[model samples]
Each structure stands twice: as structure tokens, then as C-alpha cells.
Target: MSKFKKKTGTSQDIPTSALPDIIFMLLFFFMVTTVLRETDLLVEQKIPAATQLQKLEKKSLVSYLYIGKPKNAALYGTEPRIQANDAIISVDDIFRWVTEEKDKLSEIERDQITISLKVDQEVKMGPITDVQMELREANARKVLYASIKKVDL
Candidate 1:
């Protein structure tokens, strides 16, 4: 009855124009930040703590050798085994493995290659001594023992 009319309806839909941009930004962020694991450990290793620890400078020059009891006890038994690269290998295979690894590098970088031993705290010295002897025969003298830094009580 009055000159002004009532406006009862309003736009209720949310604007989705920026939704795709936000999604793509999040995808890119995760892709850049996530670090993929390089090696899948077959052996169970609990690295022993060391009083004196020195960090390796170049990770590129280092190749890891894992020594511990097999995770699959039913198949591999409960005895300690050696793991190089991805597969579990015997002590006799050490020389061949080391040679092949050195062959992958250039002549200038061959001598700089370091063998990192990641031995479990529960392991005995016999297997380690055999591995060391094989390494000596292979002439891969650069050796590093990987261990956690001990915290003082």
C-alpha cells in the first residue's frame, strides 16, 4: 500500500572462483616440501650411541651397509645378516659389491668413496671383523661407523 516495495530474496551462493587456485597452491606446497625415502631397510637396526660423534661432510660420497638381524625371522632366521644396497648379501659378496660400487663412480671420485656401517647394538664382533677383512682386501680403506650421539645424564 506504500510507495516502497519489500525485497525478500538475496543471493545465497558462495563464490567459488578462487577455490581451484587455492587447491593448486596447496598441491604444489606439499610436492615441494615432502622428502621421499631413498632406501627401504630390510634389516632392523638400532644404532648404538657413541660418546664421540663426527658428522660426514658429503652424503653423496657415502654408501651405506646395514648389519642387523633380519626383520623376516621365519624366512631369514634370527641370526644377524648383512644388507648392502637393497638386498641381503653374505660376507663373501662384500668385495664384489664394493668393486661394482666403485665402478659406478668416476676415477677421481673413487678414492673418496666412504663405506658407512650401520650396525645394530646387539650384534656380535665376529661378523663385523669378517666384513672389515673383506673391505681390506677390496682396498676400500675409507670407513665410517654410523652411531647416534650419546646424551649425558
Candidate 2:
């Protein structure tokens, strides 16, 4: 027999025990990088209770606006409407800003713009209603209230 042993690669090659580390690392990386949901700006707002609130069949078309009370201001995204503390942003603009990813939506999906209010519970009714009134003038399809849902761990 030749001095050289069989040189073919074995079927039992490198084991896959190392793969889980790579997958776990990738998973952790994505989890850390993921964006968390934003909390409402108004800390004082006692989110109204919903005895039976149905989750919107779809995501919000509603632009985020906070009724920053005492000095009632229209707060949206990270920008606050200073000039009109009680500023009523146009529904047309609301549509654009809230639905910036519109081409992803079908035509019927384009038209429905909902307004979500995060008014402080202690705040007077006038501004709250005024906000709703403006949205109605903008021909908003729905004006929804943002309430805190209680959950049990």
C-alpha cells in the first residue's frame, strides 16, 4: 500500500455549532436597532378609557397632535405649532405628513385621513372641540381619540 493515506474530504466535515452565535448576534443587532413606539408628548393627559375599543382595521392616517394645555399648542411630530397655540393644521397637509409613504397604498387608501387627539383630560373642552371642528372642516373621514389601554402582565 502507498504510504499516503486516503486524501478525500470526510462527509463529517465542520459542524454547524458555530451558526447559532452568528444568528443570535444578528438577532440582537436588529432588536437593538429597531425603533420603539413613541409616547404621547403630553405627560399630563389622562388617556380616556375605552370599554370596548376596536383596533383600527388599518394603521393611523391620523397625524399626531398634542393639546399641550395651559398654553394650548398644536404639537405634531417633533414640531410644535407656536404661532397658533391652538392651530388647526389643514387636513390636506395632515394627509401628506401622516401618510408620507402613500405610493405604498392603493387609491382608496389615499382618501381616508383620520385625526387622533391627545388632549389633556383636565384641559377645557373648547380647544378639544375646536381641534375636532378644524379636522371636520378639512373633511377628515374620522377623528379618533388616543386612550391608554390597561393590560395585565
Candidate 3:
């Protein structure tokens, strides 16, 4: 053998100069693709668990209606309330709200709009029924009841 030693198969150190860039790209991708919770839940609306659940294919066609008791009894009182967006709304307001929401979309897409009901499990059916009637009057027939998927331990 000559003075030079034989080379052994060994892994070379990976160049980490672009590691930060790769990490930044991954971070940016997750930030862009993550589905942020659309609504700030002001009420105590713990959705009831269910066996079967279906995901809304198109998020744009969905409008959320929150029905539950106010978080602070001192401020909003102890009674249950219907929240359309940021404010607590009366039952009659549903019709106008639905109409306005529908108008935002194209006329052809109006019929495809789904009113998602996020009602509290602890609340009674009276308020829910009232909301349903209001939706019916508003002609927003596609109503979806939002619920948590039940997991059997």
C-alpha cells in the first residue's frame, strides 16, 4: 500500500446554510393552509357529540348561527341568546340577516347557501325550533346542525 490510506464509505455533513429558509417556507405554508376558527365564541355553546358527521365541502357557502347562554351573566344576563355575528340578535332579525348574506353571493349560488346551527347541548329545543322556523321563513332551506364527532373510548 502507498502512503495514502483507502477511503471508507461515510456520510458527509449536510449543508445547513439553507435550513432556515426551508424552515421558513414550511412555516409560511402551514400559516397559509391552516383553518383558523372563524367565529369568536362569546356564548357557552358546547356542541353535542354525534356518531355520524359530515364536513362542509365548501366553507364559503356556510353561515354560522350561534345559540346559547351568554358567557357573563352579569353583563348579558342569564338568558340564552341568538348570536348572528358579533352582536346578540333577536329572532326576527334572522330573516333580514339571511337575505343580506344571500345577496352577498351570486344569484345562482343563493340556493346553495347553508345555515350552520351551532347550538348548545344544554339549551332547550324551544330556541332551536324558533331559529328553524325563522330560517324556513327566510327560505334558507339548507340548514346544517354542527356537532362534535363522538369518539368511543
Candidate 4:
């Protein structure tokens, strides 16, 4: 009878010298590419879901308009309000706000600027209509309705 023995080799550990560099590169990539929300939402936004949704072409040329009830209804009332940047303003203020927003861009870029309206689904059409009229007066014609993608069940 003959006995055979199998050879065993020592395990080699992976080189971790480049690990920190890889991790730092990934972190920097995310930091640079991620678009952090510039303004916090003071009002509750329940964006309606839609089947047909398109991505906004240019983020730099886009300004957001939030319309919904204030997060703290006790302090700001339950009525729907317009939120431009960080401030909650009346519908009448939309013109000035749009003007200021448009002015931020150069003359060549002005035509490409889009005003994205984030309106709550539960809200009435009156406020939306008023905002549209104000936007027209402000000469900010490019408008977009921001909504979530509706999932098909």
C-alpha cells in the first residue's frame, strides 16, 4: 500500500498600498459629480408621479419653484405657498424672483434657462395658474413640471 500527500502553498495577501488611493479617487469622484440640493424645502412637496417623464437637459440653466403647504402649518398656515430659493413668497413676488433668477445668467444663457415648477398634487389649480401668469409677466417662458416617475405594477 502507498500513501500520497498533497502539497500545500502559503496564502498571499493582496497589496493594500493602492487601496487608499483608489478609495480617495472614488470619494473625490462622488463629491465632484453629486449635485447637492442648494436650498432646503420649507414646504411639504408631494410631487405627482407620471408615466411619461423626461430628464431636464441642463441643470445649470434650471431654477426650481416649490409650491406646497408650509411644513409648519401652525406657524405659516395650511394654505399653499410659493417657495423660491429659501424664501416663501407671495404669487406676486414671483415676477421679481424670476427676474432676479434670469439676471443671474448671461444674455446668451437667458433663453436656455428653465423654471421648474414643483407643485403638490393635492393643491388647487388657482395657485398654479397664478404662478404661470406671473412667470409670463416675468418673461421667463421656459417652464417644466417636476414629477416622479410612476412605477407600473
For TM-score, the strongest prediction is 1
Tens-digit per-residue lDDT, 55-124, candidate 4: 8667989999999999988878999988999999998898888889879999999878899999999889
- Please list the C-alpha lDDT of all candidates, in the order they appear: 0.93, 0.56, 0.92, 0.91
TM-score of decoy 2: 0.53
* lDDT by residue (tens digit), candidate 3, 4-98: 88789788999899999999999999999999876777789899999998888998999999999999788889778899877788899999999
TM-score of each: 0.81, 0.53, 0.80, 0.81
By lDDT: ranked, best first? 1, 3, 4, 2
lDDT of 2 by residue, 13-63 (tens): 788899999999999999999987664343344566665676876664545
For candidate 2, give the lDDT: 0.56
User: Candidate 1 residues 45-137, lDDT tens each?
Assistant: 999999998878888888889999999999889999999988999999999999998999999999998999999999999999999999999
Question: Which 10-residue span in candidate 2 carries the lowest summed lDDT?
Answer: 77-86
Which ranges in model 2 have alpha carbons more than 4 Å from their true place? 1-25, 38-43, 70-107, 149-153
Model 4 segments more than 4 A misplaced: 1-27
Residue-level lDDT for 102 in candidate 2: 38
